[model samples]
Target: MPAERMADFRPDAAADVTDVVCPVTFVKALAALDELEDGRILEIRLNDGEAARNVPLSLKDEGHQVLRLTDNGDGTCALLVRKVSACPVE
Candidate 1:
C-alpha cells in the first residue's frame, strides 16, 4: 500500500495528541487521550512490534478508535486515530 493510504495520515487535520516514536509509551499516550477534545483525530508514528500491535489494541480497549495505520517495513509505522466522544472529555 502507498505510504499515504496505509498510514491513514493527514497532517492537515486538527491534532489533539501525539507522542514520541515509541510503542511502550502507548499507555502513556492513552492516559493523555482525555486531553484530546471530542471528535478530534490524532496521528502517531510507531516503530517496532510491540507498539504497532499494542497501541491499536489499547485504543480499542479504551473505547477509542484506530482509524487506520501505515505499515512501514521498518519498525516505524504511522497511525491515525480518533478519540471517542462518549468518553469523558479531558
Candidate 2:
C-alpha cells in the first residue's frame, strides 16, 4: 500500500518483536494476528535485519495481506499486515 494510504490505516492490533530473533519474531507476529478476527490489521514492530526480511514473507506465505513495511530509521521497521481467513477444513 502507498505511504499516504498507510498513514491513514488504523490497525486493530499491534505487536513488538524487535527484541526477538528470526523464527521467534515471526512466531510472535503470528500469535498477535491469531488473537484477532480475520480481516483485522496488525502493526508489527520488528528489527531491521533478518526479522525484517523474513517475517513479512512468512506472513505472506501463510495467506496474510502485507499492507506496508516502513523503516523507523532506528534499526527497526513497522510492518502493517491484514489477516486473511483460512479456507474451511471441510
Candidate 3:
C-alpha cells in the first residue's frame, strides 16, 4: 500500500522490537499480536536489516495479513500487520 494509505491505518496495538535481535524480535511481535483480537492491527517498530527482513515474513507465515512495511529513515522500520482469524476445524 501507499505511504499515504499506511498513514491512515490506526493500529490497535504497537510493539517496538528495535532493542532486540532476530528471533527475539519476531517473538515479541508475535506476542503483541496474540494479545490483540483477531482482525485487529499491530504496528511493530524494528531495526533495519535482519529484523526488517525476517519479522514480516514470519508474521505472514503464521497467517497474519501484512499491511505495510515502511522505513522510518532512522535505521528503523514500521511493520503493520493484521491478526487473521484462525480457521475452524471441520
**Best by lDDT, which number?**
2
CA lDDT, candidate 3, residue 83: 96
Model 2, 1-90: lDDT tens digits are: 556777887899999998889899999998999899999999999999899999999999889999899999999999999999777666
**Residue-wise C-alpha lDDT for candidate 1, range 1-90, written one tens digit per residue:** 465565544442432223454444575556556578766776766765777777788787777777887766766776777778564559
The ten-residue window of minimal lDDT in model 3 covers 1-10
In Å, residue 63's CA in model 3 sits off its true spot by 0.3
The TM-score, computed over Cα atoms with residue i paired to residue i, of candidate 3 is 0.88
Question: How far out, in Å, is residue 2 in model 1?
Answer: 16
Candidate with more favorable, higher lDDT: 1 or 3: 3
Q: Could you arrange the candidates by lDDT from highest to lowest?
A: 2, 3, 1
Q: Write the per-residue lDDT of candidate 3 for residues 5-62, one digit (tens) a residue.
A: 7778889999999999989999999889889999999999999999999999999988
RMSD of each: 5.4, 1.8, 2.2
Q: What are the clashing pairs of model 3?
A: none
Estimate the overall C-alpha local distance difference test score of candidate 1. Answer: 0.64
Pick by TM-score: 2 or 3, better one? 2
